[model samples]
Target: MAIRITGTGSYIPSNIEKNEDFNQHEFLNEDGSTINHHNEVIIEKFKAITGIGERRYVENNLNTSDIAFYAAQNAIENAKINQEDLDYIIVGHNYGDVKHNTEQSDTVPSIASRVKHLLGIKNPKCVAYDILFGCPGWIEGVIQANAFIKSGIAKKCLVIGAETLSRVVDKHDRDSMIYSDGAGAVIVEESTEEGGIIAHESATYALDEAHFIYFGKTNHPEITDQRRYIKMYGRKIYEFALNNVPAAMKSCLDKSGYDISDLKKILIHQANEKMDEAIVQRFYKLYKMKMPEDIMPMTINKLGNSSVATVPTLYDLILKGELEGHIINKSDVIMFASVGAGMNINAIIYKY
Candidate 1:
């Protein structure tokens, strides 16, 4: 009765624009300094502070769906499961290719549908949909997929988390340098396997302290009041996460009848290297167990913050042999924790 990740895959843009590349572009600040610049001094500082060396980038014309298409195809092939077996395709994305049409244009559904046609999955029951959450979107997608499977509504689900963060990123802002663009996918199927998604728990604190990060441009009191681009009071969010994420992790671990020591690896939302280290240090002090080494490299550097795409992309990196000898193993207990806009935090335990 577990949802097993049968296969994992990712699609990074072939074009990698290093921080230094941005210096040549029109991305500059008011004081005539490079806004998205990354020279030797800046790159070294970024690596030292965030533990990120580089990030992926797509051309200006491409959109989120295009990346998701490639990622889904790779996942299908990697899993060796016939595309016909996919009864559902659920996507977690902060930005779709296009928004607000009379139809589902430039969205995940259209992307999945196109892939289905290409792969020859003709069944009408094989439907696709999208889910929106900040960084924790992928976790929410998996949990929802699990519910559909448990209720016998779906036989197999393609759960994907992808983003074209550069599309919304304010390139003129230095804070946006920590973000990049990419996509990742997972093939989740109901199985009798002993290890998979053991427990999932989430918490959404009232946006009393930090709600300014939510971004949208419209002024409609109902829909546009929230800011549409990604913004955060870094220090405030960091303190909140340091306090909340560990508690949520403890809650999920307890539900699964496991402890931090039982976990073989931990994959947190790769938002900031500094924040990740801060949380890991706290955990080490409390439990004396070593923190998962994956805290760095997943974000704040390469691929920047791909928003919802971070976890699944990191998951794919593990599967693609990038982290093969480190941090993960067969049947190893893995933990995923996320903190995003809406000031929400969630944690889940899984096994591979």
Candidate 2:
């Protein structure tokens, strides 16, 4: 028996926000001081570093749960599984549903519960819950499902990572450009297949890096009304991820007993372009090999960073042939990795 991903799906928002759209807005520093650089130069620098030209945002009428439901629905359909047979629904998200123009997050019912309701699954045995593991949440969800299935607790599970980061971003901060809204999901099940999830690794570095990515007051501190938005120390996060993520990936792959040469693709979190490139390079260097061309597929240029949603969304797109020049064949070995708030990091080595 193996814990395998049977199907995958994602919800990419229809509304596109281009980098140039911020040209007329006022960008501010953390101390409420105005940025001396022109908006054009600032945006150019951001694009050059992050490789994000545009990002998607949910419409005013939609919330995080709404998109999560969409992705879950698609995953269920893609998997061709009966809703009543699902054993669990796990959602990973940071801020709950933050409505348009609202600062408060509504999570009383939990996003997983809401998604289960939206999916209309009637089985009482279909347990549902949410996780807060930063951007690695989706992979972590899959790991949890694998545990449940391996422990004889579940047969099928729906794992989703959804976020409406645009609703939680401080528009005046430059990092706000990296935030986007999206959701991704997958159906994991116990199968007789020979290849599946082989190994995984997870870690949290809260001792000194607890607040690498956090929610704090807006950069424009003058208009303070107790409204906090998503904030982060980019330099700290970059350094933290570079120093740790690659090692975690190496550990996972080593545990899987697969040589570095067996890896067909790496679906890493779409946090930053340069940072991701460096992590992959370092990962390959550990094995005394150069990183292979096209070994890592990316979606950050168009999707930005949607936290937990990045990894699964990229996987869904590639599996569905939506991401060009990326394909996974039967029995192919691949890895999924991510790092984010909680200063958390996680990786999974799987066989297709």
TM-score top scorer = 2
After TM-score superposition, the amount by which residue 335's alpha carbon in candidate 1 deviates from its true location, in angstroms, is 0.9
lDDT of 2 by residue, 1-352 (tens): 9889998989999999999999988899999998999999999999999999999999999999999999999999999999899999999999999999998999989999999999888899999999999998998999999999999999999999999999998889999999999999999999999999999999999999998888899888678699989999999999998899999999999999999999999999999999999999999999999999999999999999999999999999998999999999999999999999998999999999
Q: How many residue pairs in model 1 have overlapping backbones?
A: 11
**Tens digit of lDDT per residue, candidate 1, span 217-306?**
322223323335444566688888788777777778889888766777677788888887777667655666656565433544666778
Candidate 1 has a TM-score of 0.83
List lDDT for all candidates, in order. 0.72, 0.94
Segments in model 1 whose C-alpha atoms lie over 4 Å from true places: 24-47, 98-120, 216-229, 284-300, 324-327
List TM-score per model, in order: 0.83, 0.99
